[model samples]
Target: MSAAPRPADVVIIGAGQAGLAAGYHLRRAGADFVILDAQQVPGGAWQHAWPSLRLFSPAQYSSLPGRMMPIPAGGGYPDAAHVVAYLTDYEQRYRLPIIRPATVRTVRRAGARLAVESSAGTWHARIVVSATGTWWRPFVPHYPGMRDFRGEQVHTAGYRGPEPFHGRRVLVVGGGNSAAQILAELSQVAQTTWATLRPPRLLPDEVDGRALFDLATRRHRATLAGQHPVGAGGIADLGDIVAVAPVREARDRGALKAEPMFSRITTTGVAWADGSAAAFDAILWCTGFRPALAHLAPLRLRGPSGLIGTDGTRALAEPRLHLLGYGDWTGPASATLIGAGRTARQLAGEITAQL
Candidate 1:
């Protein structure tokens, strides 16, 4: 028999940047809440990023609410490990109530409260915060013969670096920043082909995450005002292919060139639109991810585009639920570390008022 469910005024279903931010505000409001994380350790998805991955934003811009990330050795952008350390420290510094190694399975409405069932146990809360970000749900699109392909295929979630791909023929797929960064590295040690729906667009070398966040904020505000967005740049404006040292080297070597996506994948490699084929040892799909919303499936709040309709961060259908750090739809730049804090603060205020 299972143990009796614990009770809380609020239950947050992720302990990453989003959840942590919410916890900061909930605590400040003196609301009773608990944060649950699936990962055994802290740092959220930062713990799983590739070895060389670095934040495009510096420490100041990458921090969560009430705490700044400790600047790294050279006062430059923090790498993956540095980020992990910062997140770990943030949780500790704040003394947030976080339960780890708890994999939430479902969230169901029970009476006037929500029952969050997880491996660790169960929690009943008056309000639920679904903050699980996109890292767990990598989305790889379908292509003909993909099932028949014998070559190794991996999504960016599983890709570490070029060491394992040394001397192999690699096809790096997608046009986003992750694709560009991975392709840039894979090209250095492996014979690589970058395939994209369209050519990749890169931001100016001087523009980094801070600039991108400003542009995104401007665009978001313009949209709200129904004005012609002068800050308009497509998705690529979000720190696309930061001209980092490695990426710059790759660019100079002509490794940044891209090809149109092929029609299908074959046993040996990919087949082109004109029925041409090229052999490859592997294919890396950096095609991005969907929000990790499976645990909230019981709530039935998601609609088209796999998003929960929201007024800001509060679910439209379920007023007691708030989704943080999913993307622009939830709040402007909420998926980013810096932006999550802003959304969390606002959402906490709303929740506090309602409660």
Candidate 2:
């Protein structure tokens, strides 16, 4: 038999940047809260990122609330390992109450409190903050005969490096940063083809995450003030891609060109809508991810669009629940490091007021 549910005033799901930021605030407020993390280690999704991945912003801009991330020794954009080190330090610095390897199974109403069922145990809390990020839920769009493709197929989540595809023909799908970065690296050693639904919009060389975050902040403020914000689309209005060093290098090498998305997959490779086909040894899908809200399914809060309606961070159907770190829908730029910290500050203040 299972033990009785442990109690907390607040329960925050996930231990990534968003959850850590929330925990920092709630701790400062002296709230009785606990963070439940699915990962056994401190670094959340960063620990799983490809080894060569680098942040679009500098270390300082990608920091949590209490402490700024130290610039990497080499002084370029921090890589995945640097981020992992920073996160591990941040967790230890704050001494936040975190339960790891505690994969939450479901969150359901139990009297006045919500019961969080997890691999670790059950926790009953007055408020539940779902800060679970979307890294685990990779999305790969279906194409005709996709299942019939005999070539190796891999998604962004499973990708590690390009060495495996060396000297081979590889097809890369999607036009986002991941697709660009991965294609750039693979182009160094492999013959790569880029596929996109539309032509990619590359931001100016000077534009980066810091500029995008500032724009998002201004737009968020304008929205709060009930004004029609100029440049309301934030990063989308600027461009779809950031020309990081490697990407620019690839562009200079004439390897950054994109082709229209193929219509179907074949046993050997893929066929374009124009009746042309190409053979590839591997197909890398950098499509995207959806919100990781499977644990909240018991609440039935999602609508037909598979999204939970929210006023800021609070769920419309259940006031006791607040979703964080998913994306702009939860809070403007909330998925980013600084964005998550800013949103968590507001969310913790609101939750503190209730307590």
* Candidate with maximal TM-score: 2
Give me the runs in candidate 2 sitting further than 4 Å from their true place: none
- Tens-digit lDDT track for model 2 on 1-355? 9899999999999999999999999999999999999998999999999998978998988998999999999787888999899989998999999999999999999999999999999999999999999999999998999989898999999999999999999999999999999998999999899999999988999999999888888888888899988697777799999888898899998998999999999999999989999999999999999999999999999999999999899999999999999998899889999999999999999899877
Best model per lDDT: 2
TM-score of 2: 0.98
Residue 336 of model 2 has an lDDT of 92
Cα distance off (Å), candidate 2, residue 228:
2.3
* lDDT computed for candidate 2: 0.93
**Tens-digit lDDT string for candidate 1 (1-355):** 8899999999999999999999999999999999999999999998899988878788988999999888899887788999899889999999999998999999999998999999999999999999999999999999999999998999999988789999999999998778888888888789999999987767677777787777777877888798987546645644356676667778888899998899999899998898788999999999999999998888898787678899889999999888999988888889999989988999999989978
Candidate 1, residue 135: how far the Cα is off, in Å: 0.5
lDDT of 1 at 263: 96
